[model samples]
Target: MQKLKDRVAIITGGAQGIGAAYARAMAAEGARVAIADILDGTSLAKEIEAAGGRAMAVQVNVADETSVLAMAEAVNEHFGRIDILVNNAAVYASLQLKPFSEIDVAEWDKVMAVNVRGPFVCAKAVVPFMRSNGYGRIVNISSGTPFKGTPNLLHYVTSKGAILALSRALAREVGGDGICVNTLAPGLVLSEGVIQNTDMREKLTGPVLASRAIKRDQTPEDLIEPLLFLASDACAFMTGETLVVDGGSVMH
Candidate 1:
């Protein structure tokens, strides 16, 4: 039987890279996915549909409450109910690594707005519908950088750390409503953006591989099963937990 049959999922940042991978995985498991992103995800949605899965693309700015609210409403309307949300949007990959002191204030604020505040706004917008159905799963995408205290990306690391705390607190508040909120923290993934960026690959990949117990480049495929478990009924008894899937890097 399909684990997510008839269920609806909204995946922010579903336009490309890891987020796009998540959309494809979820849809394969029978989810009606909303490819929600600031970028256009129309091609991905159509691709999923072509592959016999149901999907729709929506443009959204997750940091904006109004935009998030509208995206939630549209997904709910199109699929009839919202059962899962994957908060996978963030400003990473394109970031230039630099000392904290040299980081521009505007750049810092933009990172916080999208990476930290984005999940907060998305949860606020979608929780109502989840509450109405008395069922929901929220998987907040975080990073292992905070745990490792990775340097040169202060704003990104700080924002990701906030996601951990946010998931814990939100889980507590919504556990009674049958909503499970959890964080999925991955190490330096070689996503499309990261692959295309010579700086990120050359500077980060070797050190990341050296640190991992498995000692291989982490791929989007490595995250699929963990993500599925977290976003499905299998995770019913778990909430407010961070599942780190980075080839055993930063084990705690």
Candidate 2:
């Protein structure tokens, strides 16, 4: 039997890249997936449906509380309940890599809004539903950068670190309600966004691979199972944990 049968999952930033992969995987596991993103995920939703999976596209700015509330309502209205939330939306793709001292205040604020506040807003909007239903799984997407103290991406790293903290605290608060909150920190994945960033690809690829004990490129496919496990009943006893999926690069 499918792990997520009859479940309804909301995957933020699901239009493309890792988020898209999550949506597809969850849908395949028998969940009704809601693809929420600032960009249009209509085509991806259609593709999931074409592949005999259940899905819907919701255009949303995760940083906006109003948008997040509406997204939660829409998912609830369509699926009757929200069983899982993958807080995967963030402002990473178009980030301009530069020294911390050189980074603009505005740029830092934008990163915080999306990478940190986005999850905060999403959790606030969705938690009540989960609480009311007495079951929910929240998987916040963090990063491995913070573990390595990765350079030239202070804002991104700091924002992801905040996610880790949020999950830990939120897990404690919601455990009584049968809700679980955990963070998934992925390493330098060779995602579409990463691959398309010619500068980033050229600059960090070699060092990233060599640093990993696996010594191979990490892809979105590599993360699907871990994601599913956290979102499934199999992880019912687990919460307030950070699962690092960084190819053994940062073991702690």
Candidate 3:
């Protein structure tokens, strides 16, 4: 049998980039996927359908409880259950380069609302359903920046750190209920968000050859396996753990 046969999944930020890659991979793995983004998830849904997978699209704002709840409802109403949730929606603001002292408080809040609050809200809405089902997989997307000590990423990096903490505590609390929570911290995936900075791009690609055991440029494809491991039944025993998907970049 397929690993996730007949399962239902919801992935935020499912409209583009890494989130979209996860959506495609989940669908390919035999899960009925709900591609939920801040806007139309239709294109991803179309792709999944074209591939003969059961899929749906739900426009969602993960930071808003109301919007998150609506997304949850749509998943349950459409698929009758929620077996997995990939909390991948995040905002990579171009204005984050400003010095810490020059940062606007409102702008900081805006980033937090999406990067931190969004995942929290989405996870909260699914907990009741997951707990009731007594079986669920939750994959929270994190980044290497939390430990890499990268400069000029105070807003984005801080939220990823919080996600790691959230995944840990929630996994401990829910493990007995048959629900698993984990975070996948992807490093230098050549993401659309990172493409804005030429220096950052080279910075990401350079350290691997200079420092790691294996030197290779990281891409969205590099993360598919890690995502699948967390989302599939193969990872039942793992919880509260983080899988770093960098190309030997930030070795522990």
Global lDDT of model 3: 0.84
Overlapping backbone residue pairs in candidate 2 total: 0
In candidate 3, the residue pairs with backbone N, CA or C atoms under 3 Å apart (3 or more residues apart, or in different chains) clash, namely: none
Q: On a 0 to 1 TM-score scale, where does candidate 3 land against the true structure?
A: 0.93
Q: Give the TM-score of candidate 2.
A: 0.98
Which residue runs does candidate 3 get wrong by more than 4 Å? 93-96, 196-211
lDDT tens digits by residue: candidate 1, 155-214: 999999999999999999999999999999999898999998898889989889988899
Instruction: Report the error of model 2 at residue 165, Å.
Output: 0.5
The lowest-lDDT stretch of 10 consecutive residues in candidate 3 is: 92-101
Off by over 4 Å in 2: none
Q: Model 2, residue 27: what's the lDDT?
A: 96
- Taken over the whole model, the C-alpha lDDT of each candidate is 0.95, 0.93, 0.84
User: Per model, how many backbone clashes are there?
Assistant: 0, 0, 0
Checking candidate 2 for backbone clashes, the offending pairs are none
